[model samples]
Every structure is written in structure tokens, then in C-alpha cells.
Target: MKPVRYTGLTIAWWLVGTPVSAIDVQHSSLVELEAAYAYKTGSWQKQEIVWRPEWVTRFDSGARLTVIGEGRFDAKDKLDPGRPDQPFRAQNTETVFPSDHIDLELREFYLDHYAGDAFVRLGKQQIVWGQADGLRVLDVINPLSYREFILPDVEHRRIPLWSALTEIPLETWTAQLVWIPDATVTESTLPGATYSLIPDPFGEGRLQVNRPDSLADSDFGLKLSTFQRGWDLSLNYLYHTIDDPLIRIDASGQQVLADYNRSHLVGGTASKPFGDLTLRSEVGLESKNRFQDSLTGEIINTEVGSYVIGLDYSGFSDWFISAQFFQTYRFTGTHDNGSSKEQVTVLIRHDAMNNALILEALGIYDLNNKDSLIQLEAEYSVSTNVVLRAGADLFFGDQSGTFGQFQEASRLSTGFTFSF
Candidate 1:
């Protein structure tokens, strides 16, 4: 997390409720959070506020070119320096501080050069490609923001990397592709419900964060799909070369060679609607040896391909009820070379209170290890664009055994989400 102070905050909303213009403002605070029992019996709870100003205007040029642009601004805790802090010292797992206040990044600024029913875009924009319940393996491209989560992920921030992607309709099939010259990785949050704090770039040498933002070499992929008998089939493939930082550190400690290869991911997921329930499932296998298959001096084995299987049911959207199960295993596991890890999660969801409340809880098990996890969640909408939420997550079964123990108990948290 960027260096910043956490105290009181200030925000202002310039309302322009015109049919073509919109603006919103909002704020919330949480006073307590939970960590392992040894860290504290509970949390000192932190507070935060965020305000956003948005405006949009659309025009048509002989119905050929559509131009649109939008601007957004964010001000939080030490961001304004006008508010004060709570009486005593507090412990916060939340990363909202003065050093990391949101800069009101651009949401969209592009022109649609439409010729018939298709067009090309040349500017900072969002490109989304995935069909799963947001747990995407094919969504390998796009800028990731480290700020928020929970809402639907329809897009990302404007990127300097221009994309030459398009969709062309065909008789029974369609063709699509996306390419950007300067591959990049925008810092992202690892699900706030799990933790609202930013982790160190390098912690005990975990490989997930160390993976290059840009896959060293440009990344690209292809997808194809078709519909039949209330059934649909789809396939996708992505290729790239990214370094593995942890591998390098480990090899240096002892002496070994490294061979990094271009990674490849080929997968397909399918779904169909059944009365009162939707049957959805996914299966995938991985391979990366084709690009880099050997290791030399200071070995950096950034190569891993895994297999996954998952199933979910959206039996109810009214009251919002859903259930899902997932399991992942790596065929090419490694540790000294690389090790395989497997995990599973059983989730349930509910939406009620005149459609004003949302609830979800998940039970997770690390099949590879004895550690297990439970997450409880709840959210209530105060209005169409305003919401209040609180939830906590608890982990059991000696977690400190890996990080070394202070306490091997829990990691509990709860907070709110609001948009204006």
C-alpha cells in the first residue's frame, strides 16, 4: 500500500441530475476487525470515506462516429486533511491512508469508429473477455486496479496500451482477437473481503506477486465457441513469457540453472439453464514446456500448468441464491523444482429484504494441507446507489505453521461498500 495517513476525511458532490449528466457522493466507517487471537482480542476498527464525480455527454457524427468521455475523482481519509482522527491509537488491516488516496483516474475516453455494426477503438479503454462467475482463467489481459472488489467486473481502467481487438459476426460462428504492444500489469487487490491491506511486493518470496506485470514478452490469445441443443461449447488459449522471482532467490541460495518458458493456457467452460437452477461447469488442462523447459544459473522456474474442475448453480437470482464447488490440482507440480497445491471451496449466497440485502458464505479446504477456512458475509442497500455491508472471515488449523507461529487461529474482517 502507498504511504498515507488515516484520519478523518472530506468529500463534495456536484450534483448534475440531468438526463445526460450524473453525479454521486458517499462515505462509511468500520470500527473493528479481527486477526489471530494473539494479534488482539479484536480490532481497533478504522473509518474511511470516498466521493466520486462523474459526467457524460454523447453525440453522433452522421451516425458514423460516436464520441464519449467520462471523468472520476476520489478523496478519502488523509486525502483532504480537513477531518480529524479517533481519540486513541487503533490497529487497521485497511490500507486507506493519505499516501494512497485514489487519484480520480479516467474511466473512459475513446471514440467508436463504427462502420455498420462493428468499430475500432484507439485510446485508453476496457476490454473484458470471460464467461465464468468472475473466477476467470481466460481473462488474462487488462489493467487491474488495486483499490476495489465486490461489484461486477465489466471492465478496467484506461490503459496506454492500445488494443486492436474486434468481434465479427458469421453465419454460425464469430471471430475475435485482442493485442496490445506493451504488455503490462496494473497492481490489483486480492479480494478485500479477504484482507483490505496491501501486501509487500516481496514477502517470504511468494510467486504470485512476483510474476511480471507484463508477461516480459507481449501476450495474446484466441477463442472460439458455438451454441447447440440448449448447450454451448467454448475453447480459449493464451500465450506469454513471465519471470518467476521466487525461483531466482531460491536458486541463488544454493546454485542452479534457470530456464523460463513462454506460458500457455488452454481452457473451456460451459453452462446451461435448467428450471429453478442453472447447470454450470468448467474443465481445463495446462502446458508451458513448449517455450522454456530448462533451468540454469540462479534457476527461475516460472513454469506451471494446472488442471481445474468447478461446478456452480444459480438456482435463485430472486433473493439471490447460488452454490458452487471448485477443486484445482497441478499435474506439473514443483517445490524443489515446483510443487502442486490443491484447494476447494463450497459457497452459498442469498439476497433478501425486499431485494435490499445480499449475503454469501464460503467454506474452503486446502486439500493439500490441513488448513481450512470459513467466510461469512452480508450487505444491505440503503438506497439504489448506497449500501452498508459487514462480514468476517475465519481460518483454522494451524496456519502459523508455515509462516512460523505466533498464533495459528484466525483472520476475521468486515466492512461496507457504497457508490455514488
Candidate 2:
């Protein structure tokens, strides 16, 4: 069998250490191992297993080096490798392989160098942005999977999973930055992984959006946060101008929209507590790209969308809750002729027996028309970092029967996750 090209890259990275000091795993050092599992349920059942081992050592000055190796496995209930003679259901004399177990994934590699409070990390990594949950208007800079975030995507959709980060701490505050010069994905990953960095459908990088050896993009971001005894506030700014997207979405429904045609982001968050209860809030915004209209013949304005105002309450030690409302208003935007959307969400969380038993509920409302979503969830901690969660999501309004983009009028799901 042909060897993996990236495995060689990992070895080369290990050989190249920093001033922090190098350790011969055969000689000196510290090492650690970690594993994680995430699963989801629904029409599609998915699961993922991540196993990694790491070695760390100090070289000289403030420099250090770390060798990280990771393996990922995915499994599904149905996957046809080939052969019409082979049934696409069972993996037997006539069964197809599930989407969950055909992976020899390498998640990370590379060395790290740090001098003073300044740090540089290179290799496969995950870049997380946005302080809000669910909707990610301004968080388009980094790659993400809603299936992984919201439900469960046993199918791994990897992105420009490598990059660098730097941080500078100051009195009472600090600054951080992320740079992803190379944003590529493994060729063997799920079909859901791809993007047109420009977020512009009719722009450059579309064809190479998900191809490897073509990760030519970067994301710049800054955040300033501090405390004032009674409350904490943070202001964030992000600018993502990509030559090609690290992550892209493919629309399969009726109103198939092109992957985001490139966009810009900006947002912030704040938190405070009253007596025994605590409160927090966040907001984000994005400016859409301008491209050819599918129907109209002119260069119409796409529009800049914004997520606004929210509140969270955690007054009781055994209970936690949050609520947020976001709407699409006009600003530095163009597509107002018919572009319209507005939503509201509410959530509640409760804990008992040291957070062993938990309950949660979330609901979404569509102000423009008749689209609303209601979800309820409950879970019991079977062990530390492991739990059984069950829930039902209900969709109401005219947009339910429409498949694709806004498919499923109502559905139910239950699953669990384990982290170790």
C-alpha cells in the first residue's frame, strides 16, 4: 500500500524543534494521551472516536516543542463502497460499509515556539470564533460543522485544520490573533467539507474550495476584555478576507443558495451577575457578498445581516437559563428587495445531584412568516464527562414540508457524548 504523505510531514516536524528544548521520546520527556467520542441520533446515526498522544519538552529560553499525533475513526450505518451486487445496507456478502468506520485520519502535527508571552503554534488545529451558539453569522472565518455543534455528525467534515496562533497579555487585558496561511482538507473526508473562501459564489477559489495544496487564506481577529468587580465586558473585531474558504456549505433544498459568497464579521459580548444569579449576552454581524442574481439581471446588493440582543440567567445553583433574539435589519447591505429573516430563541438548563440530572429546552420563532422551532432536551450524567441526553425538536409553520435548505417540519433525536 502507498504510505501517507502527511505522516512524513509529522516526522519532519518532530525533528525540527524550537529553543524550548527537544526530547528524544527514546531518551527524555513528558507525554500524555487523550481520547474522545461523540455520537448523535436521528434519521442518520453518526459517531466519532478521536485518539491522540502528545509529548512535550522545554528546549531553551522560553521556547518549547510538542509532538502531537491523532487518529480519527468515523462510522455510519450505511455506506456503499461499490458493486451493485453488494447491498447498500449490510456489510456482509451484500452490505455496504457504514459511514462511521472507514478512516485513518491524522488530525495534527507541527512544532510550537514561544518567547515571553508571545506564542506561535503550527500544525493541524481548530480555530473557534463567535461567543454565541447556534447561528454563526460573523463566525464564518473558521471552519465548522453544525451537525457536530448542534446535533451529531458522525461523518467527519475536516477543514483547513492547521494554522498558527499568537497571544500578548497586558495588565488587566490581552490581545490574541490567528493566522491560517494554509487551509486544506484531507482528500478522504466526507463530501460536506468545502468552501469558497471569498464567500462569493461567482469568485475565485470556488473550484479549489475543498481541495488540498490550495489552502491560501488567513483570518485576522482581535478581542479586548476586562473585569470591573461587578461585571465583565468584551469587545471583539474580526476580518476574514479569504482567497478561498476553509469551510463551505452545500445547499441541496429547493431554494438552493450558493455557499456564502464571501463575507465580513464583527461582534462582542458581556456578562454580569445579580445576587446569586448571573447574566450574559452576545451579538454578531456579517456583510454578505455581491454576485450575479439567479433571476434578476443586475448586480443587486446582497445585504449585511446582524445578530442582536440576548440575555442569560444563572441565579440558582441548580438551574441555568438563557434567551436570545436576532433579526436581520438593513445596514451597509444591498438585498432588501425581498431578503427578509427574523428569529427568537429561548433556553433553560437545570441540574441536580451535583449536576447529574439535567433538563434543557430551546425554541425558535420566525417573525417574518410562520416558521418556528421548539426543542426540549434532558440528560443524566452516567459518569464524569459522559451522559445520556434525549430530546425532541419540533418545527412549525409553512416552511416545514419544504425539503432541502429548510427541510423537516418536525424531528426527534437522542444521543450521548463521552470525553476522556
> What value of lDDT does candidate 2 attain over all alpha carbons?
0.48
**Residue 218, candidate 2: alpha-carbon lDDT:** 47
Best candidate per TM-score, number? 2
- lDDT tens readout by residue for model 1, 290-352: 222235333323334433345556655553444444454444443333255555657687878
The C-alpha TM-scores of every prediction are: 0.62, 0.64
RMSD to the native, candidate 1?
Answer: 10.2
Per residue, candidate 2 scores C-alpha lDDT tens digits across 197-287 of 1234433222323222223334567767677787676666765542222333233321212222344566777667776555656666655
**How accurate locally, in lDDT, is each candidate?**
0.42, 0.48
Single out the weakest 10-residue window by summed lDDT for candidate 2: 86-95
The candidate scoring highest on lDDT is 2
Model 1 residue runs over 4 Å out of place are 1-46, 52-55, 62-104, 107-113, 119-122, 134-136, 143-162, 186-216, 241-247, 250-261, 289-308, 314-331, 335-339, 400-420
Report the Cα lDDT for residue 103, model 2. 32
